[model samples]
Target: MNSDQEHYIQWQKKEEERWEALCGRCGACCGAFDKDPCVHLSRDELKKYYCTIYENCFGIKKTVNGNDIVCGSIRTILHSHWPGDDCCGYKKALKEKN
Candidate 1:
């Protein structure tokens, strides 16, 4: 790639990191507060939740309750419906958009 393209990619990576860092790691969006949670959800030593298959989390996935859900970026369902989503970082940002 050209130097300009390389720089742009690096800048985009940094921006993506910063955006991801905004998450509180609460796992609320993953259904931590519900009876059914994404099966890929895992907790770390620090008590934070993360996706086991983060890089390939999109598409159909099963929940703790054995139900299938189409996994997608949180933004796609920000204003939709989900259990315990009020605590999501993205949800907070959505409120500020008003």
Candidate 2:
């Protein structure tokens, strides 16, 4: 690949890694904070929490108890409160970066 192409590819890869590394997968943000969480939060065989509809995860969703709520990117609420947020990688990285 040309130098420009390689640079763009590397930048994309780094961005993806940065984004992926930001999530701690603690599931606290998903519903651990609320008594009821959206049904999209599912645990894998290894017990790691994952979004059932990750691609469409950013939007309105409902709690398990049927409460109306809006779901969006974790970054949107990084400075806010949530359960198990203490282990969030994004918060840690931000603190260290500053």
Candidate 3:
């Protein structure tokens, strides 16, 4: 690849890392604060939430209560309401920007 392409790719990786860093790692987005959360949800040593199947978390999945739902990117869930909707860092950031 060209120098410009390599530079752009590196820049994109850094940007993605920066963007991911904005998350407080509260796990509210994964339905942790919901009446029923995703079955794959797990907590880190710090109590931060993560998905066990994060690499392929899209599409249909079950909540802890056995209800089925199609999971998508955080972008897809941003405008909708959830149990701990107010706790989302992305939403908080957007609110601050606006």
Model 3 agreement with the true structure over 8-49: per-residue lDDT tens digits: 999999999988877887778777886688898898998888
Question: Model 1 has how many clashing residue pairs?
Answer: 0
The superposed Cα distance between candidate 2 and the true structure at residue 21, in angstroms, equals 1.9
Q: 1 or 2, which is superior by TM-score?
A: 2
Counted clashes in each candidate structure: 0, 0, 0
Kindly list the per-residue Cα lDDT of model 2 for residues 1-98, writing each as its tens digit: 89999999999999999889788787888785667878888888888888999988888888899886678777789788777678888888878889
How do the candidates rank by TM-score, highest first? 3, 2, 1
Go through the candidates in order and give the C-alpha RMSD of each one to the true structure.
Answer: 1.7, 1.7, 1.3
Model 1 lDDT per residue over 1-98, tens place: 99999999999999999779878888877777887889999999999999999999999999988998688888788779677777788778778888
Winning candidate number (TM-score): 3
Sort by lDDT, top down from the best: 1, 3, 2
Clashing pairs in 2: none
Model 1 pairs in collision: none
Winner of 2 and 3 under lDDT? 3
